[model samples]
Target: MPPSSALRRFFVCPSHRAFTLVELLAVIAIIAILAALLIPVAGAMRKKARETRCLSNLKNAGMAFFNYQAENRDRFPPACERSTGSWRAFDTLLGYTDATAELLHCPLDEIPRVRSLRPRSYAMNDPLWQRESWPGVSLNDMDNPSRTILLSEWFVDGNTTGSESYCDLGNPGTFAHANGTAGNVLWYDGHVSQLSSASHDTNQQYYNFR
Candidate 1:
């Protein structure tokens, strides 16, 4: 071959190298492994973000609660009335505390499914309000406000018989976050913190009505 032609052919590169079947398969396998590893990490990061947002929402709700009490003679809001489904006393604080209704929602909550029934994510501690046998307690009634849980993330279902629209934190099964193992609990003292399932199960007194 002419030197010039050889040089031109080499420079132009009429043909190209292609990946071998094994090499291609190996590349695909590597990609699959990387995706598998990254997927869980990404999911965990998203969950953490949602948890942080939910905590912030709880903090806003806690402030609303305090603001409501400041105007209402140091009393907490009434629980949802089971008979007429009249009004969720907590919802009444929306205007009083300069809080929007959206602030009551946890980002992790299943919005579409529960929006019609329980539009908000946080719930009131039902035991804080007087019922038949349950004695109503005020914010002042709490001896250890720092240790008590005032509000938390709750899952509400209105389809069930005798179901109320509002979340009643009096239930032991009530969760604070999406994991169902831990919750973002708002204390009467206006501090919000994460309460693990283990801690909640061990200490029922903090959640109970005084």
Candidate 2:
């Protein structure tokens, strides 16, 4: 009644096909090494994606400004605050802007504010502080909209007089890429440009309306 030795020899058990401990350990080591190499790359990719999103948001805001002019008799939207608190102008224009918090924030911002209504990554120039004015205030009304700053990631306090600010174009503060590289600037013309370290001088001709 016992099974024949020939049958047992012909059919090897499935358990015998399993990997040996050494082989399994080798495979695990290779996987661990691969993960170690890929983790950093994946992190960098994520950061770049965030930066791209930030730029897109800025472009949308710039486009919105031009659209605002079309509806407001060729005058750009008012700056953040001309006579009131930190963001009264923006608050008033909420009906005009998409008012979505994400549109106002930049991924490179270290202190991006998230509000109950929306989050903000950048701040608009204050006409009173930034020297930009509408037709009623300046004879240069034609130039106001063209010269006004639409959006910026500059969140630092510097020697810039009035409301001018400097932005950090570098990676997250904790990373080696933290050296200030380039910042995103959305001009009144609805154009976006990346400025480098030497270009950090926003007062320079490149950033100025000149």
Candidate 3:
């Protein structure tokens, strides 16, 4: 026997239901909790991306040093200029390598430009070369090029304020890193690595080339 039209209509018009207040609130609470959990993870991913970029910049800068040396009697630039500034010394490589003023700036740096020009984020290891009173160090002078630190993430501290781009291992506490605990360091052999602040201070080998 076939169903009646009224029976079909009754089945088709079955009652509809909507979420109650409690169910709606529970869904909203779940979304909020998930969002809260993901926020920190998103922040950490951003920091890691910035750190990776910083490492690339340091690596390119290290290559620039090697290129600069190849043409300039195999000698590294002075750690910093005595009269002008550290940026001035690094500027000497502008024509030698593919690196530009923009490449010298770190992605994590809050202060992009201090003076009219873009401020440098990396600093040459001051101990890599002798003081201004003595001559600059050459590749031949390094006892172990693989272990020597050439350039590192630099920042200003209490004693060294203003737009300066030089890292003195003597003041290890002043060294800054995007990760907060360790920094990307460029070695003379043209490799980049992350060294913890504690290791950087305790291990004199990173600071001393001899």
Most TM-score-accurate candidate? 3
Which pairs clash in model 3? Answer: none
Give all TM-scores, in the order shown: 0.66, 0.69, 0.72
| Reference-based lDDT, residue 184, model 3 | 76
Alpha-carbon deviation at 146 in model 1, angstroms: 0.4
Query: Candidate 3: lDDT over CA atoms?
Result: 0.67
**Candidate 1 runs further than 4 Å off:** 1-15, 71-75, 96-100, 110-117, 129-139, 154-173, 176-179, 201-210
lDDT of 3 at 8: 93
Best by lDDT: 3
Residues 1-210, candidate 1: write the lDDT tens digits: 567976887888577889899999999999999999999999999988988888888887777767777777777667666664433666576766665777877777763433334456666655565443343357768777777667766444555332332443333225455357777778778898877766654235334445
- Tens-digit lDDT track for model 3 on 122-165? 76666565445556678887787777777777544525432233
Per-residue lDDT of candidate 2, residues 1-210 (tens digit)? 877998887786746578999999999999999999999999999999988888898887766655555676655544532232245334544556775645666766664343432446655544422322444122133254344555555554433453343222221121112355656777655677775555455444223442
lDDT of each: 0.64, 0.54, 0.67
The true-versus-predicted C-alpha distance at residue 129 of model 3, in Å, is: 4.8
Winner by lDDT between candidate 2 and candidate 1: 1
Where model 3 places Cα greater than 4 Å from the true spot, the runs are: 1-15, 96-99, 111-113, 127-136, 155-175, 178-181, 201-210
Q: How would you order the candidates by lDDT, starting with the best?
A: 3, 1, 2
